[model samples]
Structure formats: structure tokens, C-alpha cells
Target: MSASTTLWTDRPLLGFDTETTGTNVAADRIVTVALVHSVGPGRENETVATWLIDPEMDIPEPAQRVHGISTEHARAHGMKAAEALDEVAEMIADALRQDIPLVAFNISFDLAILENELTRLGLPTLTQRLGHDIAPVLDGLVLDRGVDRYRKGKRTLTDVLAHYGLEQDGRLHTADVDVSATLDVLRALTAKFPTLGTSSLEDLHREQMGWHRRWAEGMNEWLTKKGKTPDVNTVWPL
Candidate 1:
């Protein structure tokens, strides 16, 4: 569809997320992953797929507490890391190939971790599989920040839901629940910012790249001012 004629709400969206062993995308492992595909208004046409992976590593107490997935449970029921990662990449690659936007609250983290896992497993990264970097991604977090630059307070998934007056019916941090909430927040964002809904997915994706770069630059400057290392990467999608 042409950039000016597209209506984002009318197209399919694939919301993805991962619950990992820790926050370090370079070294951490995914304990669980989820993809929620939805279409039409209010996301009435929806399908969800999820995976629990045996990260084959210790799940830190703090991370386990956040997602409520203990190492014991994962060891007992989760699939091998390589198997799960392969499936996850295939699902995401399929969606991207179809021109559907992959929705995530903070996409860079999940995509980075997935890429690392794929490399570690000797599998083709999503970019390699698709013959290009993944595109037409919709980041609810970036879009919210871009549209509400002056808002005061944290923009965590829960915080964003509360800001948009949406209820979270299930616990946060679980991959599937987080994906569902992310989709709702995206819907609310588009409603609040009509331009976001009307713009083509490619245009929205490019806009978010700029927004993320600007945000990261400002944050890095603040860290430097405080004599702290600037750790934020200015790249989008890792």
C-alpha cells in the first residue's frame, strides 16, 4: 500500500516479546517468547503463539521473581535453546516477509538477544534469513515517547498501559501477557496520534529509528554529564 493511503489499524500486526534470564542482551538467554498476531479494530482477530525455552543457564533469582519461571520448572518443561530459537526466528521471519509490522514495547532488546542466540546456535539471523534487516517494526515504547515527549514518569509496559487508561488482565513480565499489553498500548497510541495510524508501516519504522537515536543521544549525554559510562546503543533493532 502507498504510504499516504495506508491505515495501520487495518493491517495485521505481530506483537512479540521475550522473558530472559537477565537484562544483558549480549549474554542473557530467553526463558520464554511470545508472538501475538492481530488485525482489525480493537484487535478482535488475534492468534497467540508462545514458547518456553530451557536457557541452559541459571535463572537469576531476581529475573525468576519478575517472570515467576523458576529454573526447576524450566528445566522440566522447556524446550532446548537451539530448538526454541530456531522456531522463534522462523515465526518472526515469516511475519516480516509478509510485510506485517513486528510490534514490541522495546524492540531493540528482544531483537538483539534473539540475534545473539541465533548466532550462538549456528543458525542464520533474522536479517540473513530474510535477505535484509527486519523492517516495518512497530515499537509501542518508541512511538509513545515520540508522541508524548514531555510526559513525566516511567514508560514501562505497565506504566504505559496505565497512561493509556487500559487494564492489564494478567500479570506482567510473562511473554504472552506482555505481548498482549503491548498490542493494546499500540492501539491506544495510534488512536491518540492519528498520524501514527495513517502512516505506512515503513514510514513509521523509519520515524522510530530517528526517535530512538535522538532519545539515546540525549540519554548518553546525561550519563556523561554525571561521569557515568554512556551505555545506550544508538542503533535500532540491534
Candidate 2:
């Protein structure tokens, strides 16, 4: 909440993730969503909850190749996209309003795409719901890129997981499994960089903003070196 309050112990955090039809955050629909909430004290150690939403869009072959969610599987098992989007937006807004941190891999992507989806559905954008831009946010991908710029390979979730020697119990693309894996990544990064976990939530938020920008710059440089132009808009979580 404050610039001086530690987040890991001061308040709970909501780790979220969404799989989508594609990388167009503004246009692509969320195919699935997951939220893993950690609440209460360390002694109590209660995991609040996790939610899975079936995005109704056809899970394209390319997308399925990454997250492993097939169109038929989602259609048979998923909730309506509009309904699930509303619930996810509301839950995220609640977390922000309550000063709980929202942890995601690439927060800008998830937050931006979520904002677009909410607007398209005539629901409240995250800023409208929280009365400001989201804060007290933690991004494992951003941190990993910032702290491990010279790791010399793909910085994808799987790559980063391997870099940190963390493994997911299940495959990626499924909401709950990915969210849990992302949560593990988040913990690993913070543990590896003690300054991050020790900093106050507000300071950490500001620090991450700078970290993301630096990572973007570094990634762009690396891409240029390989004669490949980086996606300037690929900021986070698509």
C-alpha cells in the first residue's frame, strides 16, 4: 500500500494469467483465465482461491501449440467469454481497490487486453474500477528480463522457468496450471533478488516500471543484433 510497506508479508497477492487466441492484446479474446490468491499470515498460510474461465473463441493451432488448449476442448468445457471476462475484471478491480498486489508474468499485456475486453463488453476498465492505473503489481517476466538480461536465450515462460530451475507440474496454456507455474516463477525471482522482495510495495511497483522499460530496450537491442526487429508493442502478457 505505502512506499515503505513490504508486500510479501504485509498483504495478500493475486497472481493472474489468461490464455488468448493470439498476441493482439486489444483484439484477441481470452481463451482461459486463472487467479491464484494468497491470503492470511505466513503461520496461517491460506491460499485464497483460483478461477478458471473457458474462453469461447476457437483456440487456433498456433495458440494451441503454445498453451495446449484446443478449441473443441474449450467449447465443451469453458464458460461464456463475456460472463467470465466480467467476473475476472471485477475480481481484479477488487484486488486493486483493496491494496492487494496483482502478480502476472507480463502485466501490461494482461491489463491492457483485459481493459479492451471490458470496454467491448460495456464493463468497467481496470482504471475505471480502481480509480487509477493498477499499482502494487508484480511481474515475474519483467523481473526476469530485468535481472537476467544476459541469460542468452528465449525469455519465454518455459525458458525462464528452466532458467530458474523451476518446473510446472502440468503443461502451459491451461489457466490454473500456468497461473501456478507463474506463481512459482514469481517466488523464484523475488527470492533470487532479495532487494525486490524486501522493498515496499509502492517502491517495488515503481522499480518494476523502470525494469520493464529496460528489459524492452535490451530485448530490442538483442533482436536488432540478430537482424530481427522486435515487436515494439510486445510489452507483457499477451
Candidate 3:
């Protein structure tokens, strides 16, 4: 990225992602989580912290196929879910305390599940730890929606990375790898969209909130027309 861009990404960006047991924010558990800290592009000055957690439940076959983390593997080598989640929650809250944005693909899903998991384990949620709603979140999915409202295809992590010229690398579903890819996509997105790169972090975060709402409404409309249930939540981040 150019040195001239006054992007939030120009500062220390902490990219976060999680591979879970399932898609339900309330019912699912996180099997693996990754937090990637990058001080610059090209992966220079980066630190990655990852954890494999024993979700304490059977991983459904579909989830196993998506992330390749079977119950057997996790049970054999993973940290207890509550223990790992406690540390993860602390790290995230600590980062946000310093005004660092929590970067994720579709932050709501992960953050929501994380919140739920924290509560499930009798631990403080991120918001409780921070004493406020998490701020300065940089969601790649929301940013992509904001920048390209009419794009026709999927906006998965790999999809957006490819759209923005970042390679797929066949590691999209892995936690740490997905975190790295997501940060790269953000850098690319900023370089291509000047308005996004130039906005203050708070402004960008607020914009994403609105953009996500519109996208959700549009998606629900499309789903309704197709005789399908409209289940997209408009919440910015949990």
C-alpha cells in the first residue's frame, strides 16, 4: 500500500477469524481461532497467535468437511474450550482497549459466536470486558458490500480475496491462513477504494453498519422472492 494513504490499516491491524463446530451463533462452538497482527503489508512485521480448542461436542460432518477439524483431532490435542476462549477474549479486549480495529471477514458471525461462547463458559463477553460495545471493527465483508453494492457472486473470504487479486492458496477455511488472507484483502480493498482508505476508523465503522443493514434488507428481499426464508441479521457486530 502507498504510504500516502491515511488508512486505519496503516496502523497496527489485528485480523481475527474462527473455525467453528457449526453456523449457529447461539448453539455452535469455536474449534479454532486465529489473531494476526500486521504492522505493514507484504506480511512484514507480523505476529500470528492461534489456538485449537476442544469444543466439548461432536463436530458435525458438514463442519468437519468445511474446516477439516474432526472431533477426534481436537479431543486429542486441543485446549479446553473455556480455557482457550478466556485467553482469546482477553486478547481481543486488550487490543480494542488500545483502539485497534478487530478485522474479520464477516465479523458478526464470529464475534457473535464468541460472545455466546464467552457467556456459555461463565466468562465476561468482549463488551463486558471493555465496558462498551466493541468499536472500530473492520469487517471485510461489510467493506466489500459498502464498496461494491451490486457485485453478483459470493463474498466469502476466498471470493473477495480473488476479486481483489489476492490468491486463494486453497487455505481459505483454516483459521490463521484465513486471517492472513483477510488482512491482505483489506489492504487491497483500501488501495482500490480511496474513500474507504481515507476515512477515519470510526467513520468507516459506522458506514459499515449502514451498509450491512442495506445489504441484509436487499438479501432478504431476494430470499423472499425465491420462496426461501430470509435469515440475515442486520446487526453490525455482536
Candidate 4:
């Protein structure tokens, strides 16, 4: 467990993401998991660990369109959602306790979803084990929105990859592939914005939290103007 004081390039970061039955993190059951741990820096990088769990819930076709995991495929080979959820939650907490940061595209959503699942199962949520609000989280999405406030196109993982001139090695929907692509996005963003590159991971986390709130507010207002519900701002621990 490295402390948050560790240098931006020195800290170990565990990047997490989950594929679920749907987009409502609070209500959804996780169907797939992916984590990529990077230790050390640049050319000396050590990237390891990847897991794909069978989320026992019937993965809906609409959800499958996002991540390509079908109910039939998941049911045929997916691990029990409860079991996978436990392992995922514990691994994330262990990483955080050890001082390793967690990076997710939209960390708030994933962390909140995982917290809900853990609580339902009588396990400790990441916030509980961490004894603090979820900080030290690096969100590529938030960083991108902050750095390029008016980027022209979609801000999705794939869209951002193309925007940065980076190529994703694996298919988009798979967890590990998305994680790796996300890491690439972060590296590229930091490279382009030297200010972000030099900031310690802790500072990056602080900055991202502010950015997330602002972006969420703006997005919500835009949704209201269009006569739709602003759904992304739900209470995190729900």
C-alpha cells in the first residue's frame, strides 16, 4: 500500500470498472469486472492482473449493447454476482487500504454501485473501509472534461481514445480492454496537459471531484432544459 504522498508516477493504481445488468448503478447487479494494477512509471511500467467474472444476473440485451455481455453468455459462464461482487469489493478495499489509488472512467458510478452491492451482502463498502470519502480516485472522464471543456464529440471511452489519437488493443465492451484504453487516455491527457502530469495523484483526485460536481450540475441543467430527468447525480452511497 503506497501512501497518497507517493509521486504521480511512483504510486500503484488499481483501475476498476464493471459491466452490469444496466446503467442504474444503485439498482444494477454487476455482471463483469476488470482491474489493472500499474506500479512504477513510464518505460519501467508493470501492468498486471485482469479478471472477468460471470455476473449471475441475466445481462439484458440493452446492457449487452454497451458491453457486449449477453444474459445467455453470462448465465452460461458468469460467476455468481454475489461472489464476484464480494471479491471485487474486497480487492478494491485492500488496494485502497494499501495506499493504492483506484482509477475509473466515472468512478462515482462504479464505486457507488459497488458500495450498494457490498452493503446488500453485509460486506464493508469501500467508503467504510477507507474511513473517508472516496478520494485519490483518478477519473479520466472528469480530467478530460476539465481539460477540454468543449471537446466536440462523445466523451465515452472509445470516443476519447480516438480524440487522443490512441488506439485500443482489445474490443471496447470487455472490461480489461476498456481499462487499458482508459489508462492510455490518462497517460495521453497528462502528457498533453503538463500541469495535470506533474500534479500528485492526491491533487488530481481533489481536482477531479470538483470537476465531477460541476460537470454533473451542468449536465443536469441541460437535461432539464430538454425536459428530461437528470439522473447521473443520484446520491453516491445509494
lDDT of 4 by residue, 122-209 (tens): 8877778778776667888889998999878899887899899997777887777777778778888877997886786667777776
TM-score to native of every candidate shown: 0.96, 0.82, 0.94, 0.86
- What's the C-alpha lDDT at position 130 in model 3? 97
**Count of clashes in candidate 1:** 0
> Residue pairs in steric clash, candidate 4?
1-98, 54-78, 54-79
How much lDDT does candidate 1 score?
A: 0.90
In TM-score terms, which candidate is top? 1
Alpha-carbon runs more than 4 Å astray in model 1: 1-6, 41-44
Q: How big is the positional error of residue 7 in model 4, measured in Å on the Cα after superposition?
A: 4.4
- lDDT of each candidate versus the true structure: 0.90, 0.74, 0.89, 0.75
Global fold similarity of model 4 (TM-score):
0.86
- List the candidate 4 regions with Cα displacement exceeding 4 Å: 1-7, 40-54, 231-238
Tens digit of per-residue lDDT, candidate 2, span 71-170: 8887877777678887888888898888788887777877888888888878887788888768878887777877776777787788888989986777
Worst 10 residues of 2 by lDDT: 40-49
Candidate 4 or 3, higher TM-score: 3
Candidate 1 root-mean-square deviation in Å: 1.8
